[model samples]
Every structure is written in C-alpha cells, then in structure tokens.
Target: MSENVAPTASAPRSLHGWSTEFRATFTLAWPLVIAQVAQNALQASDVIMMGWLGPEALAAGALASSFLMPFFLFAAGVVGAVAPLTAQARGARDIKAIRRIVRQGFWAAILLAALLLPVVLQIRTVFSWIGQDPALAARAEEYIQIAVLMLFPALGVIVLRSFLSSFEATRVILVVTIGGVVVNAFGNYLLMFGNFGMPRLELRGAGIVIVLTNIFMLAAMLAYVLRHRRFRRFNVLIRFWKPDWPRFRELFHIGVPMGLTVLAEVGLFTAATMLMGRLGTDEVAAHAIALQCASLAFMVPLGLGVAATVRVGIAYGRQDREGVRKAGWTSFALGTGFMAVSALCFLLFGPAIVTIFLDPGVPENRHALALAASFLAIAGIFQLVDGAQVVAAHSLRGLSDTKIPMLMAIFGYWLVGLPIAYVMGFVFDWRGVGIWTGLACGLAFVAVLLVGRFAMRERLGLLDRIRL
Candidate 1:
C-alpha cells in the first residue's frame, strides 16, 4: 500500500519531451486498440448477420446484448484492477506482489461470474416486466441464456489480458482476439444460416459461436501466460491455486468500486436502449446501428485509457507525481484527437456509415437507415467528451482511487443523465435522438468533472498520498 517506493527501473522514456512521451504512449496503446476493435468485431459480426434476419432479430440481439453487457463489463472492470496493480508492482520490482495480484484476479473473476450467471438467466422475466415485445423478448431471452455460458471463460480472459498488459505484452492479446473474431465469424456463418450442413439456429447460433470464441481466447491466453518466458519470473502458474484472503480483500477494495463505476455507465446506455424499445422495434434497431458505429470508434480511446492506467499506475508506484501527470494528459490528448477525426467522419458520412449495416434495397430498412443516420450525426457531436471521460476515469483508476469516481459516474449517468433521456425521449417525444443527446450531456459533465478532479488532486498534493 505504500506510495513512497523508489523507481525500480530506470526513468521511463515517458518522462521526456512531449513528442517522446506521445510516441511511447502510442506504442503502448495501438496493440490494445487493435485487440479491443477485434474483440468488438465479434459482436459487430453478430449485429451484421442478425441484420440479415430483419429488424426484429436485430433489435432482439442488440437488446439482449445490452442487458447482459452491464454485468459482463462490470465483472471485467473488477478484474481489470489487475492491470494497475501489476504496473505498480512492476514499478517497485515487487515480483511477489504481482503474482499475488494475478492469483486474486482469477479468484475475483470466478466469484463475479458465479454471481452474475443467474441474473443473466432471468433476462426473460425482466424483459417481460419491462413490457418488451413478447415474441422478440422471448428470442432475446434465449440468446442471453446461451451467450452467458461463456461468461466465466470470458472473465478469465479479461484477467489474463490485464495481467499481460501490465508488462506491455499486448501483441499476444491482439493476435488471439483477431483469431477469435475469425473463429466467431466463421462459426456464425456455419450455424446461423445453416451453411455447410449446419442447423440455421439464428440467435442461438450466434450465442453458441460466442461461447466457443470465449473458450478459445481463454485457452490461448492461459497457455501463453503459463509458458511465456516473460511471465515465467512471476511464477504465476506455480502454486496458483492457493487462496490468500488478504490479497483477495485488497483486490476487491480496488475492484468493487471500479465494477460499479462501469455498471453505472453501462446501465445508462441500457436504460436508454430500453426506453427506445418503447417507441418500436425499428427504433431500437436504428439505435443499435448508430451505436455500433459509435462503439467501433470508441475502442480507440478505450484502449488508450487502459494504456494510460498502466502508465499512470507505474508512475504512482515509482512515486513520480510528474510522471503521472504527463501520462494522464498525454493520453487524454491522444484519445480526444482520434475521436475528433471520428466525429468528423460521423458528421460527414452518417448515412454511409449506417447503410453498411442495412440494405438500401429493402423498403422497410430505409426508415431505420434514415433514423440511424440522424442518430450518428448526434453521436458525432459528443465524441471528444466521450473520449476524454474514459481516459480521465482510467487515469484515476491507475491511482487506485475508485469510490468517488464511482459516485460521480452514478450521479452523472443516472441522476443527471437518465432523467433527461426519459423526459426528452418520452416527454418531448424526440425519441432516439433526444435520448442520445441526453446521454452525451451526461458524458460531457463526467469529462469535465473528472479532469477537474485530477487537476485539483495534483494541485493539492493529493496525488502524493494515493496507495494501492
């Protein structure tokens, strides 16, 4: 828990000129970006193939994924504490501590997966209670049930990925994740459409493909971690099954708030999606397409954010406050700059972007395509703030400061944002666009608040006091 440690390694190249720092950060970020995009592509493939089934299937798949994602993402976030902890231990050259962190990460993943799987199974009742289209809801429920079979393996992969990323060993993640996408896509083609003598199971088929992909990715990561020489020094695989309650408690202390923070943000999006469903299935489908575009672009900043967590955590571990500041600001700049270009693309080619998922030849899809285009344009306006907030949040996580940020997220997304989305989408009947704009406003608020808090922490010397 000490933050008074001397640097175990030489001063990092990140402590140099701004350009030097930028290059170093970008080097660490791009592989993470590729891995994230490839992972997202697995779901994108689902959306694309599901689109071939019709808007009802598209809506059903998107809604089910949205509902399940809150739990999945929350668990991933909790396990993600491994990255910052590993960075910190590396900074202090605390090999034993690093091993403990990884072991606890596995424990945390198992505990969270066990707790969440039952909730995933109850998707049908929740869908019904919310008065969703019963037929589509039934299909969505089946998808959730089958898809969640992968949750434990998926969680295992997250912990391993976080552990590897702390060493800046991301190429393996990128390769395996891209491989998973290929596997997922091929499996979906075979199962979903009854291609090559397979049953045309549609949503259920997609779920099965995801389960298989997760298993593959998990096995690949575990094999690499267990056998790779770079990881060998930590002895992570030796005596890995031993339980250490104090280490588990320490990880949970940092993880639970991180999990809630993630859930808060995802819950905001899911709530908006559910609200959109009330307007009609077509409306939900349109929202899904626009969101898909936004989510694709978002992986860039999200990757940078994870990299920033490692950089900042290392700096904090070395007790280098200046290094932490540089890492945070440099990452924010990189993330926001990329998002600016993405925003421009969204604004200039909204219709083109949305059409990639919908066939213009179909008269029914034309309305959804048009509406999706409009939503994309609104999505463009908030890209910069959205990017900034994520980097800021991750930077704070690097310092193991979670509780306040968790509260800030709840306040921004739920207390401030969701009400506005409700009033605008329903009360004003601006529908999907209105709901998205409200979500944007919430993101903007969080961006400003988090950046300001980091600045204040620096000025007040609170950064000197942070511990893990």
Candidate 2:
C-alpha cells in the first residue's frame, strides 16, 4: 500500500497528554465494548435457555458450543485482519487501499465460511470420536445442524464491523447488536417453548433463532453500509465478484496466522471442554456455566483491544512511534485495570453469578452449582491474565506482527497450559478446578511474552517501513 503524509499534531504525546489519550481511547472504546457484550449476551441467553431444559440439555449445548465457537472465532479472526489493515490505510489517506482491503475482507469471509462450515457440521462425529457421550452428541448435533447455517452470515458481519470500526463509527454496531439480542430473546421464548401455538423445538429452536438473528444482523449491517452517506463514496460492494488475488493473498498472509492464533487459545479451551466431558455430566455442565460467565467478563478487554488495534494502526501508518507507544500502553492500562475489578467481582460473587445460568432451587442443579462456583473463583484469578494477554496480542496485531504472537499462543496454550491441565486434573485428581488453574497459568505465561514483545517493538523491527 501507498502512504500519504498525514500530520498527528492534534494527538496526545507527552505524559501530561496521557490523560487526553485515555479520554480519546475510552470514547472510542465504550461503544465497541457494549457491542462485544451484546454479542456475547446472545450466546449467554442460549445457555440460559438451554438450562431451562435441565442439566443434560445444558451440557449438550455446552458441547455443541465448545465445538462450534472455536471454528467461528477462527473465521472471524481471519476477517478481523481487515481492521488494522484498513485503519493503517485510513491513517495514510489511501482511499483506494481501504476499498480494496474491505472488498478482499468480504472475499476472505465468504471463502472461509465455505471451507470451515462443513467441519463444524460434523460435530457429532467428532464428539463421538473424542469419547463424548453418544446421547449428548446426538442432542448437540441437532442444534449444530441448524445453527451451522449462520456461519456465513456471522463471518460477513465481521467484515462489515471491521469496516465500520476503522472509521470509529461504532455506535451503529452497538445499536444493531443489542437489537439482535432482543430479537433472539423473543425468538427463544416463542420457538423454544411452543408459545403462541408454535411447536416446542427445544434445542433446535435455539439453533433456529441463532440462525435467524445472525441473518438479521447481516442484513441490517449491509443496509446501513449501503444507505449511509459516509460510506457510500467508498462503494464497498462496487465490484463484489472481481478477483483481487494480491489483496486476497495478503489477507491470508496476515490473516491465517491471526486466525490460528485465535484457534490456538480457543482450541485449548475446547480441548479442556473435551477433557471435562470425560469427567462426567456435572463437570461439563458446570464448566459451561462458569465458562459462560468468564466469556462475558472478557468482552470489555476484548473491545478495548479492538480499539487499540485501530489507534496503534493509525499511528503506525503515520510513522509516529511515540503515538504507537502511547496507544499501546494506554490500552494496556485500561484493559488490565478493568479486569482487576472483574477479578474481585468473580471472587466475591461466584455463586450468585452461577445461579443466573441455572436455577439454584432445583434439586439436580445443586452439585453442578457448587462445582461451578469453585471453578468461577479460579476464573477470578484467570480474568486478570486473560485481559492482559488479549490486549497484548491485539496490540501486536496492530503492528502487523502476527506470526510470533501465534507461536506464543501455541506455546502458552498447548505446550505449557494444556499439559499442566492434564497433569493437574488427571494425575493430581484435582478435576475441574485443577484444569481451570492450569489454563490460567498458561494465560499468564503468554501475557508476559506478548507484552514483553510489544514493549520491545522497536528492537524487534515491528514498526512499519515508513521513515519519519
């Protein structure tokens, strides 16, 4: 891509300016934060609904989610490469480059969907091979079969989201996502329980609602992009079918590892879920509830990381090293600072939080409830490392420094984390709590490496080619 010299005179610089930087980052980050929470709320609602059908249904939903989410997140991560790339282009004032990046992003999302959706569709077979309960696998398969259709629409939304996020026009994303959650809740109510004479579809109804909600979100996003005056000039869809292989290859060049980085961490969790499945139904069910709570807490830092990608990306494009430094550290502070509060909440309120997913009044729910509360207490410690690692990884992504971070994820999650989990949970007989603590240790390791890597960006040559 080509760069045009753009001034960053108005941006905050000195230590005194850190307050201004913090304000600006928070201003951009809040909307993105709410949008992330809204999206997670969509899944959390499904988990809550699944709980209504009892522990078996909830465990099955957990298994189905454990299988499908890593695939979806991997695809979304690939599409997310568009954010930093587009932000850099925008900072350089390369309008043509911005258009091409968004176009190829759409291309990448479509192609990835075609390739990955089929893998998720075989959830039952995969679960069976992995020694999951055949009965649970059958139930989970029904949900996967219907919900898997949303894969394309969901990936498409990420492309549009990246396009919108680069310009900081993220209010629409938050608004639309909250709207989608409302629609999903209503759909779950009507479809799941046979309300208003509808057939009681149970898990299938949750899957059906998820598909419709995603389709609705995609359609709504497309409409806003098409209708909005700010975006019309770019003509993101002007020539949708034309091949831009160079940009496409560049997309994968940057995106594939980004996708796998997501896969590595989430795959660790997925593997952990499989291990939980081997323990018993109560373990799996409790893991699902506690995991859902942890995921929801994660949205804030995840959103802040997205903002950091944009801010740092723009600075990189402008060849402003000091700006990059400020952006990275400001975001890092915000992410970890917030998580400290979250960790306290998780520690203080584990039992209360667990009850939101399943009824504590029910006799069968008590054992899982106790286990989930203990697991959640460990997540209190886990939250801090989780926030730090995510923000650090995303900050590196802003530098277009991907491959090493992916390697770091592999090292932390598989080599260090999962092994510890296996030894602690199986060998030590610590079961669920041991598995979670091991995962937290893995996150802590990656957090140290990634943040250290980012801190050494200059020495590492992670800065862009442009000479200031």
Task: List candidate 1 segments past 4 Å from native.
Answer: 1-15, 49-64, 131-145, 190-205, 278-285, 358-370, 425-432, 459-461, 466-468
In model 2, pairs of residues that clash are none
lDDT per model vs. reference: 0.86, 0.88
Model 2 misses residue 371 by how many Å?
A: 4.8
C-alpha TM-scores of all predictions: 0.88, 0.88
Task: Please name the candidate that would achieve the greatest lDDT relative to the true structure.
Answer: 2
**In candidate 1, what are the lDDT values of residues 42-85, reduced to their tens digit?**
87888899898889889999899988888898888889889888
- Report RMSD (Å) for each prediction in the order shown: 3.9, 4.1
RMSD of 2: 4.1
lDDT digits (tens) for residues 286-362 of candidate 2: 99888888888898999999999988888777666677888899999999999999999989999998999789999
Per-structure clash totals for the candidates = 0, 0
